[model samples]
Target chain A: MQLTERHRKYWRANLRLTGTLLAIWFAVTFGVVWFARELADIKFLNFPLPFWVGAQGALIVYVLLVRHYARRMNELDEEYGVAEDGR
Target chain B: MSRAFANRIKKYYSFYTGAFVMFVLALAVAEYMGMPDQWIGWTFMAATVALYAGIGIVSRTADVTEYYVAGRRVPAIFNGMATGADWMSAASFIGMAGTLYAKGYDGLAFVMGWTGGYVLVALLLAPYLRKFGQFTIPDFMGARYGGHTARTIAVAGTILASFTYVTAQIYGVGIITSRFLGITFEIGVFVGLAGLLVCSFLGGMRAVTWTQVAQYIILIIAYLMPVVFMSYQVTSMPVPQLVYGTVLEKVTEREEEIMADPAQATARDAYRARAEEIGRAIAALEASGSNGESLAQLRRDKETAEAKARPIHHHAEPFPGETEAERDTARLNFIALTFCLMVGTASLPHVLIRFYTTPSVREARESVFWSLFFIFLLYFTAPAYAVFAKYEVYTNLIGSSIVELPGWVASWAKLGLVKVEDINGDGILQLAELTLNPDVIVLATPEIAGLPYVVAGLVAAGGLAAALSTADGLLLTIANALSHDVYYQMIDRQASTTRRLAVSKGLLLLVALIAAYVASLKPDTILSMVAWAFSIAAACFFPALVLGIFWQRATREGAIAGMLVGLGVTLFYLVGVKFYGMTKWLGITDVSAGIFGIPAGFVTIWLVSLFTPAPDRATLELVERVRYPSLRG
Candidate 1:
């Protein structure tokens, strides 16, 4: 149960990656969605900015966040020698 | 390719081939026999039942692992599709656009909240839960907390959340069947229940998974077809997804024009006048101590008058916030709703169980991405559909003569989904006179666009698929939670796999019957019930599940206390505000009821854990292992 340096390093790296992604998540989900009204004066692709963010923009950002997290985590797993082999 | 892969491909090929052949035959019969619209609806319903029944029979399995977790062998892509179908219940497929149509900007809470939760799922829950290798959410709860009490609390939460959700799905099925097949709502509930049970009972998760993939196909096609046609008709653009932007502009422009028009102003004034007259009459009668059928009739008359006036108010000022205070409330409600949905989505037992079916932690994460991608195909289109459908109502139906209104209007009106009355005796359908239920928007889209009757039937089938797919997943979750977590693990730990499977299947039937009966009673609106389900899940499970994964210091006492407190606050707030109408007590509306429970739950968990002794070293190591999959025990 003792934590090795390797375990600490791996945990740190994972937390760091998750933190960065979650920050972006907070920005996209809460920041954009909540402050959308302020950006309403600006229009995007013929729709109001707030409307565009609520309808399409926020969702796209969420998908990218997930994809980025998955890709980075998978790489982290490999670097840490924790990746599961295809059974 | 492996034999199972080849067999899956062949199985799908034959299934699609058979479905296509049956569809064409049904079309031909409709054309040749000149079948009525009701018969067309019946044919669609029958085809769906047969297809799901066929898949269930084909995938029938006796292996307990397969029944419980689809043998943990589902590939990411197919699992993603099945999960997509499982995630998008009747609310997403049918009621979502209708909500958008009715609420406008406020509806984005659902749009953003439901989809954003997938990010939380991929980041926080799915991979670790898959690594834990549990059959159900309660399994994780019981294992991590190491007790019957934690497991039982989880079972209670799961049943409460999933049962409410399954009832809503069944209600959606009843609505769809009654509208399409011209059957009574009660019969529709039983029919939909029968279809749901047939697929789920035969093979459990294994059958449900394949059936859901097939449903994803039907629902997406059914959902997109009408909107695509409507978009092309309005904007002369084939891609409704892109063209809806232009439609929004046009609709806004039309709204302004209607607001400015003197005729519309006069009609609005007349509606207002009538509403005020009824209001005063009711008040005067009450003041005079009138307390008989006449007073009740006056109240009913006032309700009808207000209903007639509401659309005019909408046409005049669509969004909720006409004033600054209203805007703040709307904004607060929107954020609160989205937060609740995100937490609820991540906590849902039925959804998390899908992750357990994936082969690896990586695949579980990958499947979350795919689930979101598939769900986005529908979510992104929902707003566009709302825009076009609203435009259709605003531009054409608002001013048309009642006699000249389309056949679909009469049919929908007969079902009380759309009510058009010339309150002022002006043969022309004024905006004030049209009271359209949000549920009718998607159903009427095909007819409003002048599409073939067959396409309407297809939409009905798609709705049925959406309802049935979610119901199957929900039933399985409840059944598994009861059988595995409650019966086998807690009551009789030495039970055989065969005995467990039988108990699970039996529980599935029992739960489905109870859900159908409740759905037949029809407690609330589909969207409202769906929203309440999210609040319940958010309060009951979100804190415990999230903290269990991340905070190593979290003790079993803290978790149990957190869940109980969270669920208790939510139920109290919900019942107090919703059933008892005690909104003033907590200043919490039904939509924002989770505001009270979620934060209280998190604080309780944190505070309780800080005071309690740290969990045993073995439990800490288990948490570490779950966090770092590379770590060896």
Candidate 2:
């Protein structure tokens, strides 16, 4: 369960990025969905901003989150010389 | 053979066989009462209760691991059987077929969504979660986040998700009892409750796992027999897969028959045209729903259409003739639902925990493959069942005298079971009069197709298997969360194994009571409630789990924040649209809510991870350990 210096750096960046993404998630979900009536005026790719962000945007974010986390983990694991089999 | 090895196998079979035989005998006695099938259902259920109680009286340890993870020594094949039993409940076995029956192609979404969800779990979540090596989800959350705060959020999410899912299962039990066995809805709730209590109280995971394996066999048999019978009757082909083409041909022939009769054709055409007009008006209203006035106008138009079509009920839209608008709406809804289901399956605690029951990682993978293979056997045949059931309803159930309406329908309806109204005064029941309780299609199938009461009895047994297996799994998860996550983590970390076992049993008893109360609420379709659970899971845990597995830097703060946001958004959307009047505020239809919630979860996890202080190297190493399974001792 020992951690290397590279692993420490990787976690530092990962944690910070997670916070930023979460804030955006909350702002979009509550603001757009709860206040959708007022926000319908906004549009993304011709979709109402509320509609676009709530539905399509959330799914896209899920995929991106997986990819980002996967890549970051790989980079950190490599830097620490942790064998692939260790995970 | 080693004495210990022989002793182990002997003990396992003795326990399993003894319980099963007791169940069968009880089922026989129940069938003998000639009580309505629903009442007879209780008889068999009561037997399971007695059998489990009997086991509790005899067994010594009711060991901790046995209670929670079935000793965590179940072979992959056996564990797979138990998992299949857990996953394919009354909802999948009974509800899905009925949905396909009622909705046509649109219903295919449930099957696709369900099967496809597991792919996400196998690839994205299972192996990692397994390697994390915890009793419950909160174990991982608490350890990874390195704080009680993170565990609290994860706990809350698990409770919300599990409670919602369990409520649906309870509701399904109530429904099946009322419809099949001649019982009041409340009576059905009690029957289901009694069965859950007995199964849950027995030796915990040990009892539940073995019971689930048995239930899997019963449910699969129950699910398939009627399907096989229907296929044989409709196509003269005994296998379900080959029968699909035959059923389609029959429907086509029926359409031609109706069309050739000018009088019938005219009536059908008028009904079809009126329905199309109403559909177009509804679309226009959706397109221009900019204000209250437009909404009111749309409502008025809808009222007019309802009045005109009041006597005439519309059959399903022709599979090929669906309009571009209809297809677009269906496709969008399909994707949204499928995505939610996939994510939800990946995060479902009970299902995930079952994977830990297997002895090895390779076994877990093989178990999933087996589950899918076993599942596809029925899944591929389900569409055929739907088509044939529809055909039978249209061709035989309507217009015939009560005595003549398929012997089983008459038999069942006599018990005040199915009541069809001739809304148009046509003196014949139309397909529209059929109530859409998808579970009914499977339960009523034997009776619908003129099968015997013996077949009916077998189906009832099957339904019980489905219900009990799922109840066993869900109850165990509830118990583990209470003992491992809530109590061990939060209350007293120094508690002994015996103490934990005692607390878990007590928790199981408490959950049984709560589950009974929830089951009494009696929701409409098992499938709908299941979908709601999936959407919530996708919105909450899926993003966090996926991110945590891959992102070494995912700090406890970001994980907690992501779960809270994802869960909050999903709950808001579900409660607002499903129960309350929030859909109007958002100008979003109920069908598209997940389109908004799922991505919100993902973004929250990823974005939150970036801003929070990262976990220390120790936590990252744990993450690295979870990311790979081979190193597990």
Which candidate number maximizes lDDT? 1
What lDDT tens digits, residue by residue, belong to model 1 across residues B296-348?
A: 78777777666555433331121355577766666676777788888889989
Model 1 pairs whose backbones collide: none
DockQ for each model: 0.58, 0.04
Error of 1 at B408 (Å): 2.6
| lDDT, residue B173, candidate 2 | 75
* Cα deviation of B165, candidate 2, in Å: 2.3
Residue-wise lDDT of candidate 2 within B1-633, one digit each (tens)? 234543675577567756655655565565666646555555655554565555444432456666676666676556767778888777777777777776654465555555555555555565566666567777777888787887777777666667756766666677666665667888887777777666667567667776676677666766787778887777677886554654555665675555454444434445456666767877776787666666667567556434433332122232222465654444455556555665677778888887776554544555555555555555666666777777887687644553355555654556554655443455554444433345567777887666656566667767766776787678778778878888988899899988888898888878877877766765444335556776666666777777777767777777777777777777777777777766433344454455577677678767877887778888877877775433322
Among all windows of ten consecutive residues in candidate 2 chain B, which has the lowest summed lDDT? Answer: B312-321
Q: Model 1 chain B, poorest ten-residue lDDT window?
A: B310-319
* Model 2, C-alpha of A63: deviation from truth (Å): 23
Query: What fraction of the real A-B contacts shows up in model 1?
Result: 0.61
